[model samples]
Target: MAQTVSFMAVGRFEVREQTAANAGVHMTSTSPHREPIRVGVVGLSASGGWAATAHVPALAGLDGYELRALSASSAESARAAGEKYAVPLAFASAEELARSEEVDLVVVTVKVPHHLELIRPALEAGKMVFSEWPLGADLAQAEELADLAHRRGVLTAVGLQARSAPPLRYLRDLVAEGYVGRVLSTSMLGSGWIGGATYDDNYAYVLDITSGATLLSIPFGHSVDALTMVLGEFRAVSALIENLRPEVTNITSGEVAAKSAEDQIAVTGVLESGAVAAMHFRGGTSRATAFHWEINGTEGDLVVKADRAQWWYGGTQLYGARGEEGALTELPVPARYQRSLKQWTERSADPACSVAHEYALLRDQITGGLAPDTHGVPDFRHAVRLHGLLDRIRGAARVGRKVTLTEQGS
Candidate 1:
């Protein structure tokens, strides 16, 4: 037996209430048991976007989850998406989708600026939520959403999918298993593909620093999250943030615009384990090297490289050398690490591969198969801490000084 929940439109928002008992309706995972987590996605357009390119395929390829509903910017678009994706339900607004009793999880894959508005309603409706990274436009907004989720006592997840990548997972275990014994230092250099001299209309918004979708927040943010995942959190950091290219050309329209976002970000810090760390990220792709990271230890060293800065998506390769070895050799990810992802091996570059892995972990957690504390499954609280760390990096750059992080991540 289950109780049906109804929602009434109150101005711009929806208010939810228990209406009556429903004999056939299935309850959410909040009931402590549910065969499949029904997911309703916000911003899943029929015209194609990140949701179409990644989330849709990821859900389709996974088990214990169903893409039950979707919400686009308009009713027509929603209907188009529902028909296009063969989803059962469609809504014109995110709030409406969030209030639907048929949806157990609300996945918000909208833009960074709209995250707070879209995610708040789902949290208020007491539904599980999964939002893409940069959980909010800024640190304060992320903290606010995290606080509200905490108060509501709901399960929430943030899209830091790099942590779930098989190669990265194997890399983490190698370090933990003493492959790189007594790590001494590590360094990473990457190119911020979008922050370069050329831009498209779709990405023009990121050129404005106030939009909160800058190079530092998206590419650097994602890459650093994976870095911290493998090497632990930073203890203290000093940074130099600069805008080397103030003007960028629009590739499509041939128009020039002033780019306020920083193109050069260099950070030097010490990890919690006392390992020295240095990372430098620059705008535009490098003809020589797009992504390269190395870990040096007393016993050996490890190296990771990719064609692009975004290693989470794919093309990431791991290499290592130890003892008297004069050269580095490729280290294949263990079969066990990629057991569930065998089907995605041929299409490793597809964004859906890593996303599918993340969804699998999420399913395991919801179904009581995996512990909530499992690594790589980041929640809203973790997003807040990462946001705080980003804030500290900005503060350190602004003051030209070193900032130390505390246990509480202030």
Candidate 2:
């Protein structure tokens, strides 16, 4: 029988066969042969937020990983987070955690501004790293990190979680199979009113380009990453953005805040594959507008309605519809994984569901050592390319012109 326990200690979670004492702290075997990877998570504060909710639970639930250590900026918070999440070891700082021999994989889920600070230390320690996306605050940062990893022959996986979404996978396969016919154009509409929690310190850094919370960096990143994967690399893009959410509650503190990061972003671009895409990220309304996207092609049209992805510690559900002629065809995630996916999905889990899938997929990749085509884990190569595109978008917004991507010979 599956054991169920619900708690509000750190983040809300109800796991079967685990307690608050073991929730994110321990791992059990799904198969007798599955060897668990001992992982130490640094940045348990807001930056390590996903590690608590997604990585910690995801790793614990699976037969693959054992959560050994939890770290914060200080030993006190680290101990607090470790106790709260049930991690056995708590470190005062990330540097100390990285050096521990028990930590095979050092997962760095830190703030964008502190990404380099934490990740560099882990890489230098010769541990595999699974950091969050935009990989770095900018192209230069990304390049620097990638260069270090390349030099050391260390394994790295960025938080580009959408790559593992079944719906996204379906879309990519459909396009390759010519189900969507010749893709002609793609448009994505994703926006909703920002809650008071939307303006917390976790996101303030984004407002400052140096902090890495640029519109072209995050919200724009979520949809664009999925769009590009299903479609192809972009060639040129023209865009603009607006700061609509002037005020928000501290996402972490629950206090109202002054926000300047653009609430909406406007963009149009053509992929090297010749498919055109127009995307919008908005956050000024009272109503929440879920992810709404459509692709027009010669064979047929594919449309994705609101919220195709979901994440819950209990598990994850991918929900999306494939359409041709404006009618629904197939739904993959919510239907397929509905049994394993948890019910709390409609809330915090949705934003990071795609990312969660990538972790499971990449965990399998590293098991085989570094090799090409391992569970479709993308290397620094793709991350560098993504950073370049982001640079173009940021630069375009500054220059008020279309930024073109450099096309390299295949």
Candidate 3:
């Protein structure tokens, strides 16, 4: 049997704590009329491509959700995703899926360059949306989306779910409970081997930015999201972006592939809580890698390793790892390639009932007019923040200066 731990439902956060007698007692029964959420998924490539992958699977396993529809750029792919993922609805066009009155929310899993096209329509339609990170290819688009969402009061969200992991949540709770006392500095070593050629010509807009999924968005972007989750938001940052591998080929196939996007990014910034967060992203390596971070406070220390970096909501454990620390201590996050496997199994649930957790909050926002505790879902505004940060990094490098930022959501 799985080990049970004490937990508290603080806002949307399921943080662990030792104080209260009634922690993790399943207070969900008290909140009714907050019925199951209806959901649609678009893009279905990589993470999206593997719609049957983690996202769908996680939603499928959760108690209150539905998987109403699946969308892809091509009719065949959309059909394939629906058939493979076991969704009743499938559409080739994003607009068709986004406009589903039956769908309370949509999950955008398309490429970074396609984010704007995929996002604006859903927001304008007055629907809640959740998309993969790096909200935009750059800041201007991100800002435009954020501004629009804020103006319309649309419920939007992003995929920085690492904040929901047990260990990280535990760490955050510990810090709040005085385990780490007053935090001083935090350093994250996020390294991996996403070094390969990209076949981005299929998507034209990103010629100036990047090619493969490994470099810019997945590795660096997710790292930033996770670090921010662990250390808090940014107070300006100085970044050094690098394209280490001028020529690289896909590991799966032995052929020359075009390379454009950044291979490495180093950033150091202050958290909104005034703690420091420093991180480095390096790509193109001989082997796979892991992530690790530490928080130093006035009291003791809180640390987490990649093996402990698992994201879950309900029963979904997307990607797992057991490290040198032993099975008990190490978490079993879904393996990277295995993401789509779980999503495929999620077909057993009603598509309309498989909405993600973020959308649950979003549905609440729309219907009940309540505020979300952590509205970090990948909406238009977050796109703006991410893009703005990217620009700051580029500008800092050009001027050889550090960019100072005010507190986030300020």
Candidate 4:
């Protein structure tokens, strides 16, 4: 027989079996389980936000991570957030949270501008850090952070969760196993979110290229990253970036703001695998404007597409067909590709499902010392590499000539 017992304290949900021994309770060992990784999330809010919607729920659903602490700009906000999320500790500053012995890992989800400030202290404290995409304001910042982590000897992870996606994982395997035969070329087209007509005040920062949160870095970067993951890295490339909508009216303020970020992105490159690649991501969304990426090979072709522009939000439909197969047939992503936690599937529209997968991979890496793989977790070095590629693309666009990526440090 099993008895139900609950505690109202810090680490309350941590389950332990106990047996009656005299007047005291003795913990009985039914099975051995590793303690959850204590995570401290900086910039987590009391009200609903990105970390709240995705990270919080994802962490809660997993057994390998404990939502330990939350940090906000002020002590009041931190306390409120802690209360709202039921987190044990709340700190008003990143340094405090980073230095706390209660936290085994520091997760930096703040904006790009504050990333360096929030993450640097955590790295200095020798605590593992997980920063969101666009790891820094630019490539140089990303490299600096990577170097810092290297010097500190602390592990780091990035929010390039698209790499952990199950669909892309299966797609890569299918191509490698000769389902797509010898890959010839690949192409992708998607919306940039701000590419359409109206604009929101909340998304105003994306219009500024300096913010590093523009269409190019988020959607285009993730999409291209997924593409290259299935295919291979780029060798030489030519890129063209243009800003058609120079001025946009904020829906909330009804005030026009200068949009400097490029809304139209066109890049053609050769993959290290000898396959040619072409990608064009436009701004804004429409009924017919869907995110589509196709891979053409000698034996057959494969297509990965989504109704919405974002890659991580919903599971993209994958289709493939060989010579005898009449039309493109649906290639279902196998159950093996799915997350161990089924709760993630319930929120298909949220990107946190894939984020959860990344978190799981990181947990394993931290607790079990698992090595990082192509389809598993990505670190700051990976972010630096992607930043270098984005920089090379920008350089190619600026020079109006093809640029080789050999010189970029790995």
Candidate 4 has what TM-score? Answer: 0.89
* Rank order (by lDDT, best first): 1, 4, 2, 3
Off by over 4 Å in 2: 1-34, 45-48, 192-203, 244-260, 284-288, 307-326, 333-355, 369-375, 408-410
Winner on lDDT (2 vs 4): 4
Q: What does the lDDT read for residue 169 in candidate 1?
A: 85
lDDT of 2: 0.63
Query: Candidates' TM-scores?
Result: 0.91, 0.77, 0.71, 0.89
Write the residue-wise lDDT of candidate 1 on 1-410 in tens digits. Answer: 44565433321223232222421111122223456789999999998999999999999988778899999999999999999999999999999998898898899999898899999999999888889998999999999998998677667788888888889889988998999899999999999886899999888888999878887888889988888888888999999999989999999888999999999999999999999999999998889889999999999999999887677787688999988998999998877776566888777778888888888877765664553234536788778888888889989999999999886673
Give the TM-score ranking, best first.
Answer: 1, 4, 2, 3
> Best candidate per lDDT, number?
1
List the global CA lDDT of all models.
Answer: 0.83, 0.63, 0.56, 0.78
Off by over 4 Å in 4: 1-33, 345-347, 369-375, 407-410
- Candidate that beats the other on lDDT, 1 or 3, i.e. the better one: 1
Clash statistics: count for each candidate: 0, 5, 43, 3
lDDT by residue for model 4 over 1-410, one digit each (tens)?
A: 34443221112122222223221111211122377789999989987678887789778878878899989999999999999989999999999998898988788888787788889999988887889888998998999999998776566788878777777778889998998799999988898776555588657777788988877888888887787777878999999999898988878777888888888899999988899999998888757867888999999999988878776656678999998888998987777667575666556557678788778766655554333232336678778888888888989999999998884531
Clashing pairs for model 4 are: 195-283, 195-284, 196-284
